[model samples]
Target: MSVGLGLPIAAPEQLPTWARRADASPFSTLALLDRLVYANPEPLVTLATLVGTTERVRLQTEVLLAPLHRTALLAKQAATLDLLSGGRFTLGIGIGGRPDDYLAAGIEQRTRGRRLDDQMARMRRMWNGQPLGDEVGPVGPAPARPGGPEVLFGGFVPAVMNRVARWGDGFLGAALPPAHMDRLFRDVEAAWAKQGRAGRPRLVAQVNAALGPEETVAAARREAHAYYHPSPFADHVAEGILTTPRAVRDAVAAFRAIGADEVMLYCWAPDPEQVERMADAVF
Candidate 1:
């Protein structure tokens, strides 16, 4: 199985250690709609440092909410990061869940789905070196990758799945249940087949996992709860999804059985050292 690490955007204090860690590949989780709010203003600089320091590890935006940001600017940032990272970049994107984010950005939350589609289309055009109408010409210093970094779409709803089938190169499902995953994979595969696409769609799922003696499992559940409780998956967690490593592993194995190509573990420890410790047990 291919392993990838998630960088904490919610906790900027952890980033320095996360960056300095030599054992794990760095994957930035860009869930914040506004860069000024959640990310350092100088993200490219941080990404460049990670690339220069690490030998085998790659850098990725675990996700950037597309609807809240301007398309052309987002394309430029992604392209620059890809160029700086020597093509070791993957553009993971999603339509964010918080309506407040769209409100703060002065974007209409009701129109976000359509906006995301248009934005994605525009981003692709910009990446292809096509001159947009007016003076907004081709982006300077093309991405190191020929076509640009791979675009991965994340979401679990039907609209999101349709978007993935139509435009995205991959699908990322967060905190998914295995049975639910089976249905999702079938839908995506069927869509791909209808479109006469040849290869299987890249499928990835992220789950919270904590490994330790039995005494620590409760603490792990609380950590996992902090993330899932206020989200759509809140009901699932209430149904006992994040209680233990065995529960998490069983869910992952079920996804693998149903053809999920990758599984990303979201570690919820307060300390980077604890995250590394958990990684050692799970990996």
Candidate 2:
């Protein structure tokens, strides 16, 4: 199994150093989280800037909120990024829970699931060169990879499995214990087969991590806490933050044992050295 890393949410300015360091490392991919009501960078735009700076390592939005953006525009931006990045981009999406994002986007949170389902269809068609109308013609700049970048869905809900079956690309698991991830992945596999899909879905698991001095670890813990504030699950998320080399190694091994294709560690400590530190532990 391969391992990946997530850029820090608290520091956007460090991404250039962090992305370059990760690119030169053995990590298979680099990821970023999504937040509309928090102090975080927009994943797509942030990743787009790295396309020219890095040479290896795939780029991903660990889980970008899909319901808030215009489908056609998102399709264009993703295709452009994929093309520019030499087809090294993975689009991992989720129906976000933050009501503040919907409030900001002027979208209805209750309708997010339905909206994503419809948007997925339209975005796929747009990527495959389907025009909006006879008069509108096909969207400009065809995808670098045929049929566009691979799409992965993320969540703990049963309905998320349906999305995987319908799309048949992959599933991006949240930071949960191994048992929870195994159960969720098993359900996803069954749903995919029930839908008569040709092959199994790609399974990628994610976990939050921090490796540094005690002060740095505590600071990262506080960052994670603030990010998940008000949600009861915030405490649960905090508990899962892997703080040492053994913890990171054990997490990767657990996911690998369950047949995961990749383990994405969301490194919360913001430092360029953390990249080397994580790579040494994982690779």
Candidate 3:
């Protein structure tokens, strides 16, 4: 199994340094978390900039809120990034849990699931060179990849598994324990078989880590609390933050043992050196 790194939210001036450090790391992919109501940079836009600095690592949004944007626009933006990144993009999408994000986008909260499904279908059509029935012709230039960028769906619901079976390249899991992930992988595999798809779907997992000194570990705990505060799972979130080399190794081993293709280590703090420390621990 391969290991990836998550790009933490940071000040504008600090982003370039973050990109350079991640570029230099032995990680396989660089992932991002999305939020319109939060302080982080837009995932696609941040990726657009990061591609200019890095040549090799792949990019993905750990869980970009798909229901929040116009489907066509999101499709175009994703295609553009995939092209610019030399086919190094995988779109990990979800109908976000935060009601505030739905409100901020002025979308009805209840329709999120259906909206995401429709969005995925429409985006796939756009990527497959299907015409929009307008003057622009097919959405071009085509993605750097042949059939467009890979799509991974996030969410632990059965409906989400259904979507994955139909339209996704894989499933994206966030901060889930090994047992939970084992069940999820089983369900996903079953869904694939039920759908008459040929093979098992790719699986990716994300875990939080703060791998430096005591001060950094404390701040990581605080950040974890703030990020998960609105959810019922908030308390359990801290239990997954791997702060030492052994913890990180064990977490990776456990996930990979359960059939994960990649495990992304998400840093809790904004400092680029935290990422460097993570490389030292993992690599």
Which residue runs does candidate 2 get wrong by more than 4 Å? none
How would you encode candidate 1's per-residue C-alpha lDDT over 162-238 as one tens digit per residue?
77777777787775577877787888777767767768778877665555544445554664555554787664563
TM-score of 1: 0.81
Tens-digit lDDT string for candidate 2 (125-206): 8899998877887885777889989899999998999999997398999878889999999999999999999979999999
Could you tell which candidate, 2 or 3, scores higher by lDDT? Answer: 2
Number of the candidate with higher lDDT, 1 or 3: 3
**What TM-score does candidate 3 reach?**
0.95
Query: Which regions of candidate 1 deviate over 4 angstroms?
Result: 22-49, 212-249
For all predicted structures, in order, the TM-scores are 0.81, 0.97, 0.95
Ranking of models by TM-score: 2, 3, 1
Can you list the residue pairs that collide in candidate 1? none
Highest lDDT: give the candidate number. Answer: 2
- In candidate 3, what residue range of length 10 has the lowest lDDT sum? 7-16
Global fold similarity of model 2 (TM-score)? 0.97
Prediction-by-prediction clash tally: 0, 0, 0
